[model samples]
Target: MAALSKSLLDAKKDKLPAQAAEGAHVHSSGAAQVEGDELWDKLPRTPADILRHAIKGAIRAFTLAYGARVTLAFLLRLLAVLRKKDTILGALLAAVRSQDGPRFGAFFGLFAFGWKLVSHSLREIRGIDDRWNDFVGGCVGGLAILAETPERRVSYMQQMSVRALQAIYASLHSRNLVSIPHGGAWLFALTGSQVMYAYMMRPETLPSDFYRFMVGAARVPDPILRYNCTNVRQGQVDPSIAVDLVRRYKGTADNLARAQGMSATPGVIPCAVIHPTSDSCAETNLSRWLRVFQMIAPVYASLNIVPMLTLRLKHFLTAPRTLASKAIFNTVRSSSFLASYVTIFQLCVCLHRNLHGWVERVFGRRMADSRALVFLFGFLNSAAILIEHPSRRVELGLYVLPKAVDSLFRIMVQRRLAVVIPHAEVAMFAAAMGAIMSFYQREPECMTPMMRKLMRPFFGRY
Candidate 1:
């Protein structure tokens, strides 16, 4: 019994050192974790060190911005070459000669430099770091927009304002402070009305790309658009305008006679004038939609395909077949949606023309080509938005809202209904930049997924 007791005591003594070593290991690991969790601003840094870091960050930002622009240009030009619109050498030259890349790089780089410097300096001054410092820093940084050409400043300001508003709404929604069912669809419809009106009545007010898109979708000669606008403003239809349309559509004079007889108010534009290409409105709309789908499919496909191939090469390589299939699917889906939009709008206009004739016949009064009718048709046509992907609806709504607002403001100013404030765009841009920066730092989840993704490389994730 004494020998057994001695053996147990010796075993217990050996276990004691093992337990002590395990405890020490755990404590050291815990201390290292705590150290690792320290906030960035809490780190010691001299003023000169901070400036050095800012400059380095700025260069990184510049490289990223410049690279992205060059990449996009190269891809687009390559597409043109593929279509035989340009040669390969021409495409390369176009990519190489992209003047806007340096400007974009400068704006982004300077903004990064200013943002880091100001935010870090404020923390040193106040001996505390908070989101407000980030906001102020962002505002100062946004002044780097001046690095862009004057023509681009207003455009950037408008885009930022829209994005800021969207971010605010997202934040409110996340907190349950705001809730509205089908709110995005409603917003799209409302803003879309203004956009359609501008497209018809004031195409000049729209951005160049938007105006060109409208022209292409309409598939009408410029003279026809001008004539239609004039007639709509006059609130009367002119049979005389049908002569040129009849010729353009390859219809005989007898077609105009048939149109006048079929139309209740001769002044109201006939179906032949609206869709002069085919006798059946339904058939015409179907063919137009199919044609647009075919035309845009390649464009959308390239847009998705190029980015995946170039920007996400690693991910693409890892799952080449799957990624390629998904990109193709998305391209088809987006093309279909855009085709539906254009066709639906045209169909709605044709419906409006018929409705105008019916109303005039019933009431025995001319109300054709009225602004009220135009606006009503525009609102009705926005229902095409229902066919778009649910996730994309809000994004599309936000995109068009700013343009609509710009058009409204322009119309108001033209009619002397509103006074223009000097440098209003500049002030708005600065304020919006501040809000955007604060959201980027303190409430990144409030930003759109695309916006957050674009910013992560520059700002770092929270």
Candidate 2:
């Protein structure tokens, strides 16, 4: 009987599936069962895997969307360069040739004529101030005759403001003007000077108080400029009123932060140009954030400036007006001020938004990762702001000054100013773009998830 039983058992063991045996062993002890279950849970499965996939998918989507936006900006700039290529190239060629020709002599003669036109126009414009008609007329006439052909086009918008006279001559007759056109001699010279002023002068050369006033005035919308002007004249006496103004502008920062999915911490200023004077208006978090921004700003600013220097040099040499060159110059020049202004303005606005929340009696939500993303978003938005500001008008005046003077001297001496403006502008733009890209790449992880999600719809699959 034992022999028969043993034979049956052997047969049953042989017939049993391998999986079944393994399962039996797995479930035999409580510890083993728990361990087995854990192992199974750790392994990828349909639902959890789907969730993980979704998150990754979202990130990819956002990245593509951001990339597209950047590309679009670049494309638009490229289009501008294409449209302006002739003017840009002509300017370069003129700069190079100015080093060795009678062109310098003609340019100086034109510069003097342009200066006279601008002075006469300024006196008339400043006196009237109300009749834009006359101002426009004079500007048009001056621009047409004061500047040389290519420089005139560069200063097409400014015409021949006296401030621009030097720059125009410097740009055109780097060495000397061998030839000067007869049709609009004065207008052309003035235009050249305008370009010089816009491209050469530094911030320190500007009237500090006037610049500050302009900064303040920019805050007042066009519709309210007159009303605010009156209010200032009357010496209106309400601290709360000023606070309200600050608060209103401050809302812009909150909107920006929310758009980026950053926490809108209460009573914290996101950015500001003017430092806070009153302790009553202070928020600790905002103060700290400002400090961090201030610390990093110099580093970024330095990086950005490096390219600007290169662009300046390049323009001095080649003077090409290709899409690449324009992009570099515009990006660097605009970004420099934009970075400073946005940092200050946003910080102020964030503070105001936070204070408003505090006033509303809501518990302030701390930013995830302490609002690290906010900093990055502010930085990016600054690029757009820099591009749009009216200060560019002033910058144009400054940028052209040194070059115009140099050109004037060369024309008088029959020697080259030995610098190229167009190539320099282009190089500056390229360097700025490269630096910005670097900054963005360093913080790829900080990009918001929503931005990623929006990108997904476009990429098809990632």
lDDT winner among the candidates? Answer: 1
Q: Please give each candidate's TM-score.
A: 0.84, 0.21
Q: C-alpha displacement of 288 in model 1, angstroms?
A: 1.9
For all predictions, the C-alpha RMSD in Å is: 11.2, 32.7
Pairs that collide, model 1 = 237-267
Q: In order, what lDDT does every prediction score?
A: 0.73, 0.35
Tens digit of per-residue lDDT, candidate 2, span 73-191: 34333433556854545544443444222332233333223322332233233322122322332233233222235443333222223223333333344446633433122332343
Summing lDDT over every window of 10 consecutive residues in candidate 1, give the lowest-scoring window: 19-28
**lDDT computed for candidate 2:** 0.35
Best by TM-score: 1
- lDDT by residue for model 1 (1-462), tens: 334434433553454333222212222245543432333323324577668878877998888777777767877677688789999888878886878889888988998888888876664565444577778888888898888877688888988998899889988999899987876677888898898888888887788777887777666555667667766666555666666676676764556666555422355666676666667778878988998887788778777876676557789999999999999888888888778877877887777666875776776444555666667766777777787666567777887888899999889989999888877777788788889988887667778776776776765432
